[model samples]
Target chain A: MSEDDAVAGPTDDGQLVRVEGFLVRLDLAYEPDGHLWVAPPDGSTGNVRIGLDPLGVETTGTVAHLVVGSVGTRVRRGEPLGSLEAEKFVGPLVAPLTGVIRAVNPALATPRQVVEDPYGTWVAEVLPEAWEEESAQLVRGADRLPAWFADEVRRFRLEGVLAQ
Target chain B: MGPEALLETPARPGSRGSRRAGRTLGTLRVLDFGAVSPVRSQSLWHALACGVGRGSPAALALCRPAQPYVSLGYHRPLADLDLGTCRRRGLPVLRRLVGGGTVYLDPRQLFFQVVVPPDAVPAARSQAVAELLGPARAAFEAAGLPADFDQGELAVAGRKVCGHGAGLVGGAVVVVGNLLERFDAAAAAGVLWAPDAESRRRLAGRMAECVGPDPTWPVDAQAFAEGLVSAYAEAFGVTPEPGGLTPFEERVARRFDRLLGSPAFLCGPGGQSETQLTERRRAEIWTVKVRAGVVEARVVLDSTVLRAALVGGRLRDVVVEDPEGDQDPGVATALEGVTEGSPALEALARGGPSAARAAAAAARLLARARGGGE
Candidate 1:
């Protein structure tokens, strides 16, 4: 999955509220990490629009191999959605919500797309039954961006990237 | 019962009931991943350790490292290893969470691990020690493999064929052991303590190392692992459900990645260095055997410059030959009862001072031989 796909942007928190199949945030700028995240233009049931908060990309090192589950398979919330093999080690791609796998980006199978166009690469799109419950766990909007990113960075030692 | 089918408990940091409710537990979950080589074994050990540590359910994994290697306790010093020997022999040195002396492992050996909660038994201390050392004896007895535990050493006949160790973390205990099936004795020899080396060589020479050297034992790797899993499951009455790494375990893996990335934890003692080493190295440990009518003397030398000999069953002589060549007259009486034909002779052959050094350069030799170093 792309860096952009790991945590998409928070457009208008209003639109990003809970949807049935998936959640969509149309117009928010900035995440707790200060990265600008946005949703994809496609209006698919499984794929949600996602973009990274600016600082999110800077904190996490360059993307490596992206491991997405078999497309079109059923998944549960918090299941190992897959993994993002970072430059250092394989980082997890946690499931946002329980749903059936609808689609995944073909670019992930090849290592280059992750590095060349991480923002454009879409990981996996799940059509969730409860979007609000899942999105509630994700950080949305500019104010929450920094803290969310900081917590993860501190916990995973993403600060290793910052040091580099 | 394949490796992929092994079930792992919930990994998302939640109660077991919430994640897995009434999943039909298998009678025996055999995770046969063929023979995973050493490099892969390291990773599997990490993954298994992390899984068990986080209550990710019980599992049995079998793998063989591609090359020969030695793994020391977490706090063991790299200096303890003869790096030149390891490199020349194409062996790698690794550090593991388990506490014990260094071990030599290869594909010829079968690695078995038991991941379970500490409460599996009533008495934690005896239970912890028995889990690895005891089960092997039972399994071998059942399979007619001739196994016994001689003072925590899992020996076949009179020679040790298994080296076991355990690591307790986060309320979960992981016991790992290796069955030396058809390994290179010479290569493996370089990894043992000189004391153990002498013991092994004597035992091998007597053909007493293994009571039944069953080269054609019906128990293959998969069958042996499955038997152990089933034996343990039956003994513990746990119906294992096959599972895989949970999402939370992956998160834990991320945490592990961060931890391993730090050289301090991997390299240094992280503050428990001295305590761990001191605890592991016991002094003047005596394993007595009435059958042999001899007290197996294990003297962990703490200081240098003393030519200490286990003549017969006692400290036969202590000669210190330094700038001040001083011979402790008390040593002759200390060696009073020890005889020439005891196991002490074997220890002397392997670790005792040479005749010339025993008489002339006693102090320097004693100093160098302190700590019973390999």
Candidate 2:
């Protein structure tokens, strides 16, 4: 199928641009802020995944610890999630999609293990039964976050929190 | 007036000569309930949770714990903790409802809780969280402690005396943290179940980096809490009515009874079975290979060792391969469980996992490096 057909929106195909890198789109959802979705393109195996848009990593800085759940565990879309340890924050790991956890990176059990190899330390994998259902609520591949990420960053800046 | 002389209780409404023309924007009441025991931190947290849960504006005075402990955010992993150290030291470990990094607490510290209605201060983002730390710093000044808002942690001369974390519930912003009087640095390092010698080294290095040089002042918890209450009243422009718990607060406490007393929340949730991968897994699995330029570390794990590595970061890269096994039996023996402790994992995380392990492989390694090798 044509790339345009697979994608939900318009493309820059007119330029015939061919970027050299692998890309895997992911649909994400989380709790505390309520339900939302996003399909982020796959980055590297060890590079940090940022929440530039809403559904990305919200807090700034390298991860200090990442504890994911067991594989085959059935998770709801916006459940209590897992846990993430940043330099200054330790937050819960909410589910991005409701599905069976396919895998969790064992490397993350170590402190700052994810920061050392964020891409390599993929926290967990889930085979969502309703990827379409969840993705429909999320921002498309190239769209900005519907939620106020920039505003939140600005608030953090005003409070003297530097972005890492 | 001196910098410390800046603290003065605000005048009550309708009693001041130049009473500013204003209706109650909101009743900004502060509470100086005085010192209880170290256990009061959670009691105060519950009181604040009630106000926050119901979206009420409030603040409280708090104190640091006498014994040291490790606190995790709600839903954090027990595996992240080094249970052996906690067991050895008899230190308590608990999980908090707010979101933030793990923190160590002791008697030398002072704590404060701010429960404001949602949007009390406009941006409720990470930076905003730091802004909230402003009152805490002011409180330190009020109490005659050299404290300031430095990054996310509170510092006195580049060393952190206070660290804070916050969360919102039912439209109430609850921010909490403490000031340090004393810390058991040795015990603090002992909390992690380091997977290997190298990782332990990195952990120690990081702790030292963050801790920096210690302070020279004596920390008084009671005096500190009082000072913070005065500071909060000044910064938020409110009058603190030294008082007891309100009915709503009491109601919420009863509602959250399990939360306050549960072991799961207090000690962090127990690790899942998979989180405790066995030593066989640690021995057989091909772990991540690390090349630190100066050295290299290759680790293999079985299920048991894998679980240990999962608990902490040390052993993930601890197995050594000496091409010439006869090169040095003494050194090899020393490196046997190089990454088996907390400090080792910390060291490996900061420095190279291999280099740290190699350095600790034997007294000969240290001796040779120091020009005293056999």
Candidate 3:
């Protein structure tokens, strides 16, 4: 499919794009290196929800357990938000933006929902402290996302993470 | 902290090592610490991993524990192990920063840990584990074991020889595995919390079949370390240089030594909360993973008790008992070879109500082992 065809326009809820069978939400800004997404602020709370992107969930294997940072803890960009343990692998979940954790998802107790619905299952909600500065480092916008995402799929495939 | 501060040994004037000093760019530092205390064997590598962004070189660490101990994965539930038994046996239980289930460790196993900057490996966690463990597999093969890397574990002829765990610690990616010269299956099974003697015996039997190297193969610890260093040096396109821990790494190690020994860390993320304890008491079902795709479980419901072993998603060696001391031999025979969640399990209902209840409970136990339910 052409890049334009791969990306669908924004819906009433959000915009989504399909790249190499992996879903990418264009409305959310992403920390490309960490494979995490930050949703726009909630209407009333001004808190942004953060979660693993689809590619992140796929690459990490089936997440068996999760330990998210407790509510009210402050984190700097690139700092550990928490850790995730898959069947064969384990690693940290990095903060996508500088923020204080306003709340942690209850779904972490049983991580099946997080693995099954990466985009929909937010891991934590944060009140971002420096969105204007840090958001520039993130990947967003329809014009930029498709190419970056396609490149990522190609890279993971080359690295033997995805099927050839 | 300059690059010199990170050097294991200070470069001296007119010394033969002088020209090759100062970070030794493109060189893999080899830290060969002979046998160490059980806790140091783990904390040393963790310290190096934490130093990745702070000028720690790409390195390999080799050591064996001077004493036997039991280790739990970072996220594993503390209830998986029987602390009372461990204490009675004088075995120290530790929790590692890496991920995997609980494992029994001792001096017979030689540990090799590779720590590198995260960018040096694939961003994909599975791919990273496989790539990092490639050299260990090679080392095993060089020892004439015909080792294979299957899904992040090293096995010989379908029996696992190397149990591996990997994770990102600080700015570094660390993958740790062991070359098992010998494994005491009964001792390994002793640390786990089993419901009774029969279930523990079954677990021991399964562990003997799945883990450890073939006893006939002789493993020389020095030769294995040399082979590992050579393989890693070749893979990373770097020369091997003998080194020691940097000052920064020493501080980190000291800090980790205390943290890893603390009660809070040993309890891990799955510490026994009151709710979990109550739920476990209510369910009275426990499952322990024997290895990849193998699980042994014990379930107690009402007056009935069931002990089962599941290998490769198929039931095996099922034993059921009731208060009346009566168990239909047909229940065991009928469930034999049945895959988990098969309609055949429900078909046991035709045998009798008690048989049906046992079959249903067995199915749930299998489901829990498969990570489908709690």
Candidate 4:
């Protein structure tokens, strides 16, 4: 779909804010570097799924491909999980939680999965070893996301990286 | 990149977030492997880069690629290059683990590699690139060239004199750059994978324009190596200890040699259909030169619509060419929300929660259309 017609659909699982035609998830915690967001550990699995928020995806432009680590690979928080090569920028997909990879999403088989529903397409599901410690380093929930996301949008716009 | 991308600004010294690591590891080891064939030279640096670790001696390498070769970045696609042309031209295609665009390597350019502890490098990529290339920039200036480090490049009068790459290896960082006495611009540009000769000419012309002019021939490679050594030594506060590769390094380099030389590695993931990124698509750019000010932006875009103007750094004015009555109202509202008094353009980069992403994207085109930035 052309990017102009690719607005975010109504989000059912989380609180959504409509920004400039894109639906941004505000309920999840975002990492400091801006590309990653972590949902708090779900009760049954206690695994936090990591994904990209809409604003970050917008700035990165169209992702041509994704290179991610396989399952069971132990990853450190803040280290690179994989590199995303896109038309506009090439950068690392940083991990949010420090732990073993319990699962990786199958949707990312196509690069378009990322463009379609950035927040919905989790790259990896990590079983965080220390949620209290790691989540403390994250900006969680609606209270923190608005300012952070807005600031990021502003930063990206001035950085001249926003996709046209 | 357009002509505005060539405008060189003075380096903001010390802004590159990295300072002299100032760690004295007793002595710096100079691994002056004078010359190797194209493929081996690349492998040699890869081996040394991976060998860098905590307390590892600051190892420096100087070498020349004995023949011409085109090296691709680790994740870049092979489809971006015309390998048939490369084979016909006898330029072996190779890949580097470092990430970036592809480049041409030949015997005339002197290669320099400096490996240091990763902690000594800044966490920010831009800062680290600035900090690590700082020494090389100093060397070029000391050599009586009017040089400065801009981004990851060392520039002389706005043309690139040095191109560089950096990566983490075994908990250390190895930063590399080239000292060029000459470059074959036509040949360098000619190898790109373009369908038509005209496209190649346009691209090659741009690439040649970006590179600094060739230096005088009969250049002193040894003296140039000395300049790099002195700069690196002073940066890290270590003494130079002349040495060759030990048995272990040789063994390691041998492994890298085979691994890097294999057809699978050379072809890389881009060559394989399973791992290939998108085939290259040229953007269709149309510029609308409005008075609103923002300058110099280079983007490999997914959009064919980029209306850029070269203006000084102030983001003021909006021309929403919405002939269609159906264009979203949020876009106009978002543009109107930018307050008059802000320290910089970044302050206007965002809109309220209800703003559309299209507004931001359009504003980016507007901001860049007017040539102004920090």
Best by lDDT: 3
**What CAPRI grade goes to candidate 3?**
acceptable
Encode model 4's per-residue lDDT on B1-374: one tens digit a residue: 11111111101111111223444456778988887988678777766654655245668888988888998766656765777789899888877655456778888788888776544654334555566778776677655565765433577655677766655543456677788767777787677665455445544554555574444524455667778889888987878888877665667677777766577766654245334324333422222111112222222233212122223432323323333224445444444434333232243235432232334444555443332111
Please identify model 4 stretches exceeding 4 Å from their true place: A1-36, A41-48, A51-66, A70-80, A84-164, B1-25, B215-220, B267-278, B281-374
lDDT of 3 at B252: 84
Model 1, span B224-250: residue lDDT tens: 565666677676567755545566555
Among these predictions, the greatest TM-score belongs to: 3
What's the distance in Å from true for residue A44, model 4? 9.5
For model 2, state the Cα shift of residue A26 in Å: 11
Could you give candidate 4's per-residue lDDT for residues A1-164 as a string of tens digits?
44333334336765886544556677678775645778888999999898877765665555655666667878777665665644312345666778988887877656677777787688889888988998888876665565555555554454434533
Who is ahead in DockQ, 2 or 3? 3
Ranking by TM-score: 3, 4, 2, 1
Each model's lDDT:
0.45, 0.45, 0.76, 0.58
- Per residue, candidate 3 scores C-alpha lDDT tens digits across B1-374 of 11111221111111111111223236688998889998899889988887764667798999999999998887777777767889999998888878888899999999999987665765556666777888776788776667876545778876788888877665566889888888889999999877788888988988888888767767666677778999999888899889999998899888778877688777665455445545654666877777776778788866778787877778788888876535787887787778876888878855576787788777777776666443
- The C-alpha RMSD of each candidate to the native structure, in angstroms, is 19.8, 13.0, 6.6, 13.2
Model 2 lDDT at residue A135: 50
Q: After superposition, how far is residue A71 of candidate 3 from its true place, in Å?
A: 2.0
